[model samples]
Target: MTRQGQGFVRHIELDSRVGTDRYPFSLPVVTHLAGMGRLDLDPGVTFLVGDNGSGKSTLVEALATAAGFNAEGGSRSFRFASRSSESDLGDHLTLCWNRRPRTGFFLRAESFYNVATEIERLDEGSGELLRAYGGRSLHERSHGQSFLDLVYHRFGPNGLYMLDEPEAALSVQGCLAMMVRFRELLRQGCQFVVATHSPILLAMPGARILQIETGGTIEQVEYEQAEPVALTRAFVNHPERFLDRMFADDA
Candidate 1:
């Protein structure tokens, strides 16, 4: 029913009387990665991973959209903490029964420029976002620092948050800092569905990982077992050796 500090993602029992169309799709529900042809996810932290063009972003967008969220909604999907119930929005994507997220945020790492603009619009009313960096616009801050500020100031507990390629600007140490913040939020029952390639971010223990390969469906695996994690570890653990071989004696 519930996972300690985590909220309950109750199971939905579809009634035979309810038409399939009540769901988001005509194609049978792609509820599980294995069913869709990869990984199943628990209600906790679900990481969707794959190479670029592997459809990872597409899947997260669909999930957010299906949950009555706009495709490009940022940290505040349908406004900041405006409404707690989104069930009335209807099916944009098929979901299991009892699917309702108390709060939701979508963080598109590359589209952070848009986030800054959106915040500027809000600055007319409240200067919270601008104040994040002592009155400097997010533009004034480096990419990674700005992202950290957003998560630090925008994120709340008991919410479902999605992140795409958050590693774009974060240095290794910054990523670790983000992880610390993430752990604090997770303890408060916040759930994360992140799409990232950074080995540091992927190392969040106990988070569920979904890997989507080329022509492959999403599948759940341990974080340590992820291809990106493995590859990054190998590279970092022995960079000189690997680099020497990679660019070796080509001279």
Candidate 2:
């Protein structure tokens, strides 16, 4: 289970001189990175957890782009762009690689439809490309099913995967399934960088959880300390209490 020296990317660094007046650079998390110099990555799985706009997704997207995956979400070979909403932060980000991945994927939940469309286009004339993705167009499957298909069929050993809010389309059961797949892939020498809000996904054993604070600080935290886990536990344990607090004014 020792993952030392097994990851493709060792760390990521930001250029100190990168401009700070832009959309992403102005973001608190990005500003933190500008001063932090470098962020070291775990060799197995690294989970970025935070509230909305904390810059977890933005960081994951920038990492994927800097690592050569398409900004719209797909493999390195995928070159189609539906639109250009991605920030230019990737250009200023630098990855330190221990070894290059033989295969890889960037999966952004918001833009997966475009990735599927690109897959269908590539599968034109022949089904070779489609076969690699569960032998069916991702569009033909339900959202969660398609995500699972990609994890089970397209992803392989010794690959690098970056995911942003993968739980957006998945149910609780699906999240458990993804966790199982992630463990299997990790044992097969794959590495993952994920930005997620799901408490279930955050419980992956041995995964490094980096919690992004509101002030733009990223700190490694235990499963018990992760905000998603702690908050979910509180809500689940005493729903009435939380509900009462929310409606206290009315009472």
Candidate 3:
């Protein structure tokens, strides 16, 4: 069930005038968003899930960019660019804001190494600058530890956060910890937009799972119906049943 709660940006709509025969514009997800005209976000957490190459991450990245975050990842203040491969979809997006947030961050799992490097550069070996990041270099910690510290330290009350595939660095235990932290942050009036395939992360209470279907249609699905949850449940319940089918000869 989706609970109506305080959120920052309420929804996103694509501009109608944008050209259709471009790189990102040609992506099915982009076409769907363009055709649909608008995508509503859950006031608390919105989970985008789909099979690989489905463009869930692309949409999340565009949302982050349109919301004033660095394309690579980090807080709005971060201006570092490891590379410039972002789609122009963000440029045409119109974000409907409930209110402006004092603080926010865009955390992209794929490029967090660059963000960490930037953090270290900004800190310049000063322990004072590292205080906001658990008082140590994110590079010094294990991948999972660094992510944990990000939530516990850098994230705070009334903040807006966009994360793409955060589960990339987490173990099952880490996912659970992040869920607990998410609850705490929600109580503190935070909002989250995340793209993930982790059924565990999708199980966070009251989160709205928006699954990007084939051909780029985005639909709001129940937790049980979410692709990750349904598939993972099936595989765990009977791994051999699935493996056998895979090994069996095609008809």
Candidate 4:
């Protein structure tokens, strides 16, 4: 049976003194986090949903950093950095732990190529370590396949995972597969905090949806009300009308 308290992180606390007029602090999500004090997380799955530029990805990166994962992506043990584009919000934040995770990974879809390079470097001539990641070079696989392979072969029980825009590399079918994988992980005493725009991912059963409003106000909303779901539903249902309004200014 799963442990009574299965999650690694219970909530996140932002230091009050960390607030300033700096770039990240000036970001609405950071300011909102500072003002609100703490962001509570669900033990199973917590989804961060917002439109572009709403700072949801920034929050996920900070949370992953605070939890000791590499800023660019990968497990806690990875230390490779191609370049730095992350804010210092992680340095100023604290994670409240329900229980420490035995294993975990932070995945940034945009920088996963860097992670693949690092994996090859670590493997060198020996391919033993690659076994955990489907026993082959991630570079050899298609982008979506690599992502799925990482989840299926590398992810394990009692883990904490933070993902940023994983759908960026996935097809609709791939997203459906990922949802199934996520459910399995949840059952295995793993916890996930994902920042995503996929309405499909938001449909995970029992997932908590946290929507970041303009100016960084975070609210717990139902799946249907999530911006991605609502917007995608509207667009799919009435593409012509949506497109007409979207181009109304030009028209």
lDDT of each: 0.63, 0.92, 0.89, 0.91
lDDT of 2 by residue, 140-219 (tens): 99999999999999999899999999888999999999988888888889999999999999888888999999899999
Ranking, lDDT, top scorer first: 2, 4, 3, 1
After TM-score superposition, the amount by which residue 34's alpha carbon in candidate 3 deviates from its true location, in angstroms, is: 0.9
Weakest lDDT window of 10 consecutive positions for candidate 2: 1-10
What TM-score does structure 2 among the candidates reach?
Answer: 0.97
Residue 175 of model 2 has an lDDT of: 94
Once fitted onto the true fold, the runs of candidate 1 whose alpha carbons sit more than 4 angstroms away are: 1-39, 76-92, 97-99, 125-136, 240-249
Candidate with top TM-score is 2
lDDT of 4 by residue, 1-251 (tens): 32333678989999977778878898888888898888899998899998799898789999999999999999999998888899888999999997899999999998999999999899885998899999999999999999999999999988999999988899999999998888888888999999999999999888899999987899999999999999999999999998888799985
Q: In terms of TM-score, how similar is model 1 to the real structure?
A: 0.74
Itemize residue pairs with steric clashes in candidate 3.
none
Clashing pairs in 4: none
What 10-residue stretch in candidate 1 is worst by lDDT?
10-19
Give one digit per residue, the lDDT tens place, for model 3 in 162-225: 9999889999999999998889888878889999999999988888899889988889999999
TM-score of candidate 4 against the unseen true structure? 0.96
- Residue 245, candidate 4: Cα error in Å is 2.0
lDDT score, candidate 2, position 82: 85
